[model samples]
Target: MDWSEIIARSEKSFWGLLGLRMLSADSKLVELGLTVNESHLNSMGIVHGGVLSSMMDQAMGTLVTAIKNGSQGVTTHLNVNFLSAMRSGELIASAYPLHETHRTMTLRSEVRGEDGTLACISTATFRLPRDSK
Candidate 1:
């Protein structure tokens, strides 16, 4: 499926509530954005790690979906590195392909906050469904 359809379906998901926007989606790249708000903050008054992780994971998985020509998949593994703290601003995540096969795809992603400061970096592997239909 295209990003538009995926995002449209996401409209009622937990991630969708974060107000993520699909900036780009194609074979080579996938980028998404979310504006930080009170609902996204952690106890320390910064964007929560889970939120960052979720966005990064989604970015990578969506990229894999695009690269797989619309095949559905789920993240099997995700590793994240928190580089900086974000108080409030737009947070963006972008992913690029690292490796792939007929059944699996690996990708690297990064999250940036205001002024393009790096907030998190992540690597993920997505397992495509065995049944395409």
Candidate 2:
């Protein structure tokens, strides 16, 4: 399947609002890229936790949809850990499923800076589509 189509469908939503791009994707994994700018910064001039969380959620959710053959699901829980501060530069988030059941999929993700620093780590659980297992 053309995973790019999944990202294309998100273009008009918050994904587009944040200028996130699809770096790569497959049936089991998804990677997203974002260039951190002032708009993504917090009061301390560092990347905000929300931005990191959103990026991780997007990647994980996209993976779920890809594996489900384009059926979308909703995020049920998200946990993010900030490891380092990011002031600027590119951020890449990669997510893949860690576990799955009939109703839920849990994914693990990491956001790395351009310099290859582990800026954040995240894990999220998405509720699969009603008709998906």
Candidate 3:
């Protein structure tokens, strides 16, 4: 399925923005892009950290979803590193599966600004469903 169809079937808040297009997806990777707006800004006038985190989470989770074998999972942990400020404009986030086991999966993601500068990096762990039938 396409990104729009995936969003329509999932609970993704940021999916409402048309900017978030799926550049690619496969059994091991997922990529999404977004355009920052006023709503994404914080008191400092830069993109909010929460928004960045959410996007990172979504990208990483999508990677996990693609690798899983007809099972769903919940994020168990997320580690993020903010390298630079995300200005209000266009940006891209890409994720890839680091590892996957019978009960867990690990993913890594990076957020890049419109200029292709690294804004943030993240790693997430998810617990797979026990009944993965």
Candidate 4:
């Protein structure tokens, strides 16, 4: 399938609201890119936890959808761990499958900072479509 279609579909979603780009998508993984800006900063001038969480959430969902071959799913649970903080520059989230059953998929994601530091680690569970095989 053409990955552009998947990216275009995200243009109107919350991911777009944060200015994230769907950089790449494979059957079992997905990557998103973002450049930190003032709007994404907290009062301390650091990237807010919410922004990191949202990036993980989007990465998990995008990976699940790609794995399902466009049959998307909803997040059943999300857990995030903040390893560090950042003030600016580019960030990327690389999400890959941790496990998958007939009804759900769990993903492990790493959010990397501009200098390639591990900013956050997230694990998310997604409910497969009702008719998913």
Candidate 5:
């Protein structure tokens, strides 16, 4: 889907409130972009870890949904590692599947700053509904 379509699809959701934009998406990878704003900052003036974590989660979930042809799943586990601090500018989060079975899919994702510094990395597993299997 195009960016506008993606935005329209999610505009009323939390991702839209965070200003996440779909940079690109395919069966293998999905990239999401976000411009760091005041609302995303923590008390220390750095981007909050939760913001990055949410981006990674969204990226992984989006990819899994696409791979399953719109079958949605629940995140069973999510592990995030904060690698660097970011104060401003933009961030891009990308995700792809690492493994999958009839009812579970695991994905790896990373978020990088505009300068290409890796800010966060994560892996998540989603459990598809029994009917989606």
Candidate 6:
């Protein structure tokens, strides 16, 4: 699918207000790009943890979706490590599948600033739904 279609679909399906454009996606790898707007800022004018968590989730979920056939999954657990502050600007996140089984998938992601500084690292576990069809 095209970038516009991906963005639209993600926004509708995930309620992700931020326009996280997919830069690339393939088996085992996915890259997402986003810009922090005012809505994403916290009271301190820095990006909130929730926003970073959402971005991490999206990156990890998109990686899982690329590998799965017809099944979908929901995040069962997420662990995040914040390294540095993220101010309002552009950022990129890359996610890859670290491990996968019949029922579960684990993904590792790193959020980086425009200057290539590491902002955060995250891991997420998703429980794959049983295919009914």
- Model 4 ranges with Cα > 4 A deviation: none
Q: Which residues of candidate 2, in runs, are more than 4 Å off? A: none
Q: What are the Cα lDDT values of the candidates?
A: 0.87, 0.89, 0.79, 0.89, 0.91, 0.82
Greater-lDDT candidate between 1 and 5: 5
* Residues 1-133 of candidate 5: C-alpha lDDT, one tens digit per residue: 3446655878899888889988887779999999999999999999999999999999999898778777778999999999999999999999998999989999999999999999999999999989884
By TM-score, the best candidate is 4
lDDT of 5 at 60: 93
For model 4 the TM-score comes to 0.94
The candidate, 3 or 5, that scores higher on TM-score is 5
| TM-score winner between candidates 2 and 3 | 2
Residue 37 error, candidate 5, Å: 0.5
**Candidate that would win on lDDT:** 5
Write one digit per residue (lDDT tens) for candidate 4, span 1-133.
Answer: 6767767777788877899987788876789999999999999999999999999899888888788878888998999999999889999999999889999999999899878999999899999988976
Question: How does each model score on TM-score?
Answer: 0.92, 0.94, 0.86, 0.94, 0.93, 0.88
lDDT of 2 by residue, 1-133 (tens): 6666756877889999898999988777799999998999999999999999899999999888878877777999999999999999999999988988999989999999999999999998999877994
Residues 1-133 of candidate 1: C-alpha lDDT, one tens digit per residue:
5466777788889668878888888889889999888999999999999999999998888887787778868888999999999999888999999987878888999999759999999998888888643
TM-score of 3: 0.86
Provide the global lDDT of candidate 4 against the true structure: 0.89
Candidate 1, superposed: residue stretches over 4 Å from native = 131-133
Ranking by TM-score: 4, 2, 5, 1, 6, 3
Ranking of all predicted structures according to lDDT, beginning with the best and ending with the worst: 5, 2, 4, 1, 6, 3
**Least lDDT summed over 10 consecutive residues: which range in candidate 2?**
1-10
Name every residue pair that clashes in candidate 6.
none
Candidate 6 ranges with C-alpha deviation above 4 Å: 1-6, 13-16
